[model samples]
Target: MAGRQTRGRQRIPIQFIESQDDMYATFSKRRLGLYKKASELSTLCGVDIGLIIFSPTGNPYSFFSPGAEAIMERYRNPDQPVSGIPQFIDDHSRTQLVQLNQALDEVLEMKEQIKDREKQLDEADGIRPKGWWEHVPVESLNANQVLTWTTWFENVRTQIRTRKEELRNGAGTSAAPGSTR
Candidate 1:
């Protein structure tokens, strides 16, 4: 611990960064953190994890536990058969993200068909399109629709972070050191 900080650490108050530069900087750092976290969760649970996030500038990023192709595959088309084992990856973030970027792009693309249907739903029927949370682009959604989608995204992010913390704390308390090879 010679190079480590002498002070203890605590979680900071969460708020949106107002400055564009600061926001971008934080986004880059936190994006890396999300990768670290997903890797940790995959290792801890011995399960494959797939995560996709779009940057403040709309660039997409993904993290997958080697087994994410099936996920990206399924996302490309859920009706398409999913066939693979859940294989946890070590540190393959960069390579895996590059390999799956096309699928990520497809998932992010604005669906013209859905856009027209969403209009009809909002104007006439008033029923939110089911599963829009998955890949519906904001360009097709109204302010209220976007707000609801964002709220759901934030809630999901909070839950993922909370679950990661719980797993970390649980492992820390055990002092098992189970990997002493």
Candidate 2:
């Protein structure tokens, strides 16, 4: 007998995922990895890099190093000299905005989860389940219940049989117009 095969990380083809949910999940995971790599590059190389990604759901994501603003300034206007003071101003604002947006998103998600959990608990509270009747093999709990349970079970069986017979008879009548019960 063959043992279970080990399925490690397999490379996925670079192609568009058809499912919307799967696409979003893939985007989030890849985006995170990309950000980490960019961060590592900036730290190790001591170079500035600004990375921007737009999610499939249209959310904007960005990572900026300390030198991000200076780089952007140079890109925008090559002739104009880059200034360190202005770089701090721009980077500070971008940092604050990114932090605020992330915090708000996390708070909203936490609030939503709490609300859903509360609603579920509230609904469950209304059920008020208790007693030996809640257990399976309910007849074991109360000997008196044995007769009642048996009768109830038989009633259900009888109803099912009656319903089946009625359906069969109805179909037979329709199929053969001259037939009468």
Candidate 3:
């Protein structure tokens, strides 16, 4: 059997290794090959791929394309590992706020029209308009109206300030705020 016209180099079929020792060796080699391919693909295509591999033996290996860590550092928890996804719920929330504000503007305009009609009715009846404060433009209102708006504007400003604070705190750290990358 020692190559006396016998099989010298038998070709093992390309199948998943089942034996523990063979599996481990194949896993290690294949893992390295995969990472090499990933690196090559990133370099050639100018793409970024974040890869995390855990061996059957519980060994962990990771590969990240260039600027991957820096990219992940932004907008992610510094202490936590990052996946290749963006936390976009906040963006959706901002869009919803904008839509809600537009809807609110429409509602306010309707309310102003109703108030105008009420004023006209009061004048026809020789009654003084219900309140003098209703005459001002929405943009140029007094402290009481400002106070009323404070309920809405205050929450928006607080949310903005909180995000700003988070950005400031996350800068330069692994928790760095990502810039839509």
User: Residue 76 error for model 3, in Å?
Assistant: 6.0
RMSD of each predicted structure = 27.9, 18.5, 30.8
Which lDDT tens digits does candidate 1 get at residues 21-72?
Answer: 9899779988999998887676556555788899889999988775566556
Best by TM-score: 2
> 49-72 in candidate 3: lDDT tens per residue?
678899998988888754444446
Instruction: Return the candidate ranking by lDDT, descending.
Output: 2, 3, 1
Ranking by TM-score: 2, 1, 3
**Where does candidate 3 stray beyond 4 Å?**
1-16, 71-181
lDDT tens digits, residue span 1-181, model 2: 9998856678988998999998997899889999889866865575667888999888899887655656687678979865678866756765765676579879999999999999999998789675444567653457777777778668767866876788887744333432322
The local distance difference test score of each candidate is 0.67, 0.74, 0.68
RMSD of 1: 27.9
Better of 1 and 2 by lDDT: 2
Tell me the spans in candidate 1 whose CA falls farther than 4 Å from its real position.
1-11, 73-181
Ten contiguous residues with the weakest lDDT in model 3: 172-181
Which 10 residues in a row give candidate 1 its minimum summed lDDT? 172-181
Off by over 4 Å in 2: 1-8, 79-81, 87-181
